[model samples]
Target chain A: MTNTMTTRRKSNLTRGQLPKYTPWVVVAAAVVLAAAIMTLVGFSAFGWGVLAAILFTVGLTGISAAVEGARQAKDKLATCLVFGSFLIALLPLISVIWTVLVNGIPGLTFDFLFYSMNGVTGQFDDAAAAGEAPVVGGVYHAIVGTLLMTLWATLISVPVGLLAAVYLVEYSEGGRLAKAITFFVDVMTGIPSIVAGLFAVAFFAVVFGPGTKTGIVAAVALSVLMIPVVVRSTEEMLRIVPNELREASYALGVRKWRTITKVVIPTAISGIASGVTLAIARVVGETAPILVTAGFATSINFNVFSGWMASLPTFIYTQIITPTSPSNPDPSAQRAWAAALLLIILVMLLNLAARLIARFFAPKTGR
Target chain B: MSKQTSRAGDRIFSTTALMAGVLILVVLFSVAVFLLIQALPAFFADPSEITGGEGFWSYIWPIIVGTVIAAAIALILATPVALGVALFISHYAPRRLSQGLGYVIDLLAAIPSVIYGVWGITFLAVQLEPMYEWLAEYAGWIPIFAGPASATGKTMLTAGIVLAVMILPIITSISREIFLQTPKLHEEAALALGATRWEMIRMTVIPFGRPGVISAVMLGLGRALGETMAVALVLSTGPLILSLIQTGNSTIAAEIALNYPEAYGLRLAELIAAGLLLFIITLAVNMVARWVITRNKDFSGANA
Candidate 1:
């Protein structure tokens, strides 16, 4: 020990002794080594991960124990655990997307996108079940129904939601009514999508008939779900606008109403648009509400005010659970996966568009 | 558009706003009242009037238990990973990557629930069966893990896990936002005192964000309570209640979705009654969450 200490650098002893690339080199070796050994035992990525994790932890701890000592080794363990938590959290997201794509891709096609299930029956679907023919029918009608109902729901929700938000932001002084409105809106935000459907059904059952089903009823149900989201997001956007701008408009001698319309709204319109888009995305995939209120129809119904309508969510649901053919559910399962894929794509686009709109419309702070 | 002419327009617009506010309240009251009226038959029905001689208590006990257990299990499974993701995105990710990671979370949130249902039934359920059997085989001493050992994957445990995956992005996004809002001074002070990166976060960030995180968890819990299709699809219809790892028990939302189409007379009323219960439970949770937020002027973000 005395002879080695004479040759050892004092600077290295006081500072750090391990190489900077030590962690990476050890981690790589651990992973590759664990993978090979696990393959010999049984091919499981989970087993490989567990083995590699143990190797990484013990190996790093041991190496640091020799060089940097105990405190540094403990720090490394904590850091690894933090990183491992992140990876664990990310696992489901990756798995869900990968599984959806792998299973969903085979179900999507030109025929699937364009054609409807107008005349398709169980016997007609049997060919697809045999893996000998392309899947029968498509989600075209459901897509149309989703579009029209969402459009109407948007139209209904936007006006009411916007007006209330305007009141909350521009008019109300936190009076009793306003306070009640705000509290109830928070409560309303938690109402399950199914409960809204029940309300719509009950409303129709009492007012119109016992068994009325229409696209409009579905619209009403969706509107119930959309209003709170719109109000919350729009309210947040409105509050963040600079008060000096509103004051500047007032200083210019603009009427109170004109100031709100010309200056305040134009300033916040982009966020409001994005908020509305997000609210739409939030509800478009709701299955239970539409299943209860609209009832599934294979044929396209253009009008929202009358008759049963099928949306993508319900279409996927009925196809999977009840199936077009009781004897062969493969075709139905395929269609379900396809419709799910379509819905996910639509939602993804809406989210992307919302972000773009929000970015574009945000007040330019360049000045 | 002159001031004088627009006075009437302004008045009308303000009145419309008031009307809209009134409409929201009206809608809430009506949902409660109408559901109550529909559910009255189920509450009042005699044994002679009942289907299968099932009273409201017997009909609803399993569902109530199912709802509580599924949501509780989902919350348990999701909270740790959610907190980890929140911490990572808020404190640890590279500055250039953090914003992109947040966008990824939003993308996860935007994916539809029905798609999750289909995937759970189609893939996850099948993949999870072996693990369930193994748990029962080795860890049967644990009450929740102990099962009748059917080895079927469409059990309450699967429902809980699927619900956890479905709710993950939400709790993470909210908690991440809360952590991001931690004042820099606190974090800097901790780090200046010789704390490691993780230690600084534990000392400053989580304590400051606790209320917000709690509310976020409550919000996730509310979502899990009402989640219908995924639970319906993944949880096999059954009557057992205690052994969630086994193939039995269904939540209230799934119960209504599964039974509503075939229900008649008192049966339909009972389903509506169940729906009402779900609405009340979620509403209570949301109210508490909102109260927590509003209790803190600094955290509420409401200008008012």
Candidate 2:
């Protein structure tokens, strides 16, 4: 028996196992083979990379199946596919950011941020394109319009959204009315931004008379989109507030509303605030709704209740669609890219702020 | 006196909260009502007077088909890739890297649609023109690839691709959350049976995640259907055609956005009517998605 066992051990059960560095070796081989193939055909970097990845995957899977077995090969194939999908999904994101940065930075000058397109004309863009002058128009009025409209939208949405959330969590108790509201709110979240614009237009056209476009109308349109987001986020936060806190308030003879106001809201305030900021970020870049509701203006308009207004997104759209100089669209395209950069900056800052607020002000739970 | 004041305060507070909740329902109701009222004129108007010299239905039909084709392409391209991405984050990725990767994906969501529009029109279209020409030359026998291919590459296929990118994050995040919530016991049992990692996942995680994945894809479909600015900016406008590689075919949202600025009277009502159609389509899609979620509420971690 001892002699037989010794002979078996000498033969080794690890005969079919792959070396630890097999994948690395396979990758190197695949790269070299892919480059040779690419040279034979017409070579492109993207094509070379694709060939290398395919060769690496096939080579490793085939070798594994031949030696280790089919199951291991399947596992390896799955891993490659999942990782490859992630890399492919990331390509568009990287390209978009790089493109925006490369094209946007040069157009982002002091005059572009501080001046409006009010007095600028085709002649200026024409001259700028001819290399005889600097680009003259700016996004100042658009910036003001965006801020004012977003501010008013927040004012309109927050109170309504907050109260609706309060009712849903504290008062509703899954009643019929509450269920209806909940369902409709979910439905509301799916409303197209442009449809919301149309709703605002249809509503105002009847009451305020047709063809009345203003910053206030744009604000109303934005609020329709913003309110549902705020309500959903606030409701989630409120529901997570520990029931013990509310019970403790009740045990101390506190009123229901008072307990909600004083205890529950305080505990969830950080989440609600961050959620509101996110909602703002979502609406701040809306172009279609604002375009249909407020129309566009070249000059700054301070009063939201009167006059057509221009937001950052509409400014970008109009610039691209109807260039200040049709013959030379480069200047107009430059302004659009610059405004896009500014809008992206504003959105990223808001997102960062929301993250910071959520992290720093989260309710303490003893570790 | 304190009792009286407390009672009054409760009354006021509760009433205000109730009113706010009711207002949401009212707003939704009014949106449908107002749209219908405005759209009545277009329906009643003479067919000859409409933009196409036909009725509203004829004018709207092609764009409706265009919208569906674009959204279908988006869904088909996005669903598999999104599922793969979700699996990577939930199962294959290192724990430390997964959270950061998830955040990076969410950043894709936060970029506004207009930026996507600009990127699609200026960058993607220009880059893909060559590929379209190549496909037209080599794959021309295939009906969809049969193109006197677009010179500028502003085609339905390009818009669909942009839409695919736009909705990828939504589907990925939702599927990731559901994939993470697969029961630990089931996974361990599969592994204990000497299953490979992929087999174990197929037996446990995928089965558990199937409904959740379906609902997530549906929600992504709803978003893609309703998405406006990207399609508006990316696709070149013309009458609808069968080939996706051509520069023609307009979506309902894009039609409204491109024309509403200069349109007036019946033209305005026609656009509003089209908006109503879009609203109904999205509403139905979202409702079905929600119904699926609620039906599977017991098994899903979606609500949590």
Candidate 3:
């Protein structure tokens, strides 16, 4: 009886007085212990983190189990699991950020940033031997191509997607054709980007000539990929433009077209802009379709209508896969990483701007 | 006169809208037709003349197998972790933390696939060597882990792991959305019945989200099947599934990306044929995903 009683947890009155920050203290101790062990064993940094995480989990649960009792232990375990799972989910994301920054920074210099590699030798990277490293090149042409192609894609996709969305919400009235269109669009949403590229190639192959490659073709490919997303998002935005507003427009004796153009569109324009921006961000990193359609070029091709264009994605792809300097591909790898960083930055900035646009332009709700 | 103008304006806008909607169908149909037209020669060609020997079947079949196996690996690895994260966000995390975590996860989707490839090749493949070796040593009897771990770490297994990381976010976000939408009354009722927190979740949330979870996985599978660069960058070439631990193989879409640059004539045609297969597979998977979502709309616990 005495042994069992001694093993029992303390009463609430006594335990309540215990330090509330005890768990954090345990965590700090776990981290230090984990670090000491990792250093002694010569483990990697990742291993140290994993060890610390495990120690924290085990330590907290044990501490809670001993002091606070079983129910509290279970709760603490659940909490630890949640935090641990989140950390695990975040690991690769952290890896991505770290790798891009670490490997990408060394590749960014003035010449690498500014000059187009139009006249640069491709078969042999002579500049590499001269130690004028990074292959004496810049992604200027690729940057121009990416912007030019994406602009064309946005141009081609936005109006069509917007109108299609407006029609679905405003005029479909739940018709079968509308239903079918919605269903097909959902399916189209899953078509591989590479497949879209193939479609463009086949389209141009028959229409213009076999093996035709150009930025316009790539733009069309991107447009194919972007339309479904745009339609889906725009449709959601347009649907939410309160029926009361449409009724009010109708009550004012306005035509359907005019009401849609002025009231409905004006109300949803912000969300629409955000959606379009997101669609652009999504397709701008595409390499497969561009690889198939636009093809890679070392020099900048100003015209989208003819000639192969060098987009950032395809540029990175070629640089990584088949470095121009066979003797030392380190410069090429550096360039690829740099291009990747630029692409990530562009996408991230676009996302931020889209969120800002959505927030800034949102209609104020009456409190 | 004003009425006539208004009516004519309505007609024009409606027609334009109809045309735009119909254009989506046109594009979908034309992609199928285009792929078919381009691939017909490859399908009809003499088996003896195909690239990589043993005829077209040898070249194409292995790729299809590799794709399925890789996606299977991704699905297996990602599903549980994604579910845990989703559940953590939906049920466990503080409300503020859950929202922030969700936003962070969605950013995973925004990071470009090519960037994923870069990371996969430059970091993940190298970092996972110890794990592969460990598995090889301990689980040698298991066919998948039987042979020696490749020094390069460019095997299909590694590619799948990269893909697992790539697809985790989408699955997490979708299932998290579904789990979050569980009927609140059901949850309260379960709790009121003296069920443990996990029990309440198991009974209420997981049941409600089962269909959504399946659909989310299917969507992830769709993404994994079509992912190009990550697979291309992480994998070496050739079919190595029989050896399981062998360092080379390719998915159909990855093949397209890797081969498209230098491809001409039959090579390009064969690649397009592969793309066609990928298109059909994703299309079917997506159709089923839509069907699953729409079919259970009433049962999905949404009030509306």
Which is the winner by DockQ between candidate 1 and candidate 3?
Answer: 3
Q: Native contacts retained per candidate?
A: 0.69, 0.79, 0.72
Q: Model 3 - which docking category?
A: medium
Work out the TM-score per prediction: 0.93, 0.97, 0.93
Give the DockQ (2 decimals) of all models.
Answer: 0.67, 0.81, 0.70
Worst lDDT run of 10 residues, candidate 2 chain A, spans A8-17
Residue A72, candidate 1: C-alpha displacement in angstroms? 4.6
TM-score (chain A only) of candidate 2: 0.93
Native interface contact recovery, model 2: 0.79
Q: Chain A of model 3, TM-score against the native?
A: 0.89
Q: If the candidates were sorted by their lDDT against the true structure, best first, what order would they fall in? A: 2, 3, 1
Residue pair clashes in candidate 3: none
Q: Residue A130 lDDT in model 3?
A: 59
> Quick one: best TM-score, which candidate?
2
Looking at model 2, the pairs that clash are none
- Candidate 3 structure lDDT: 0.87
> Model 1's lDDT to the true fold?
0.85
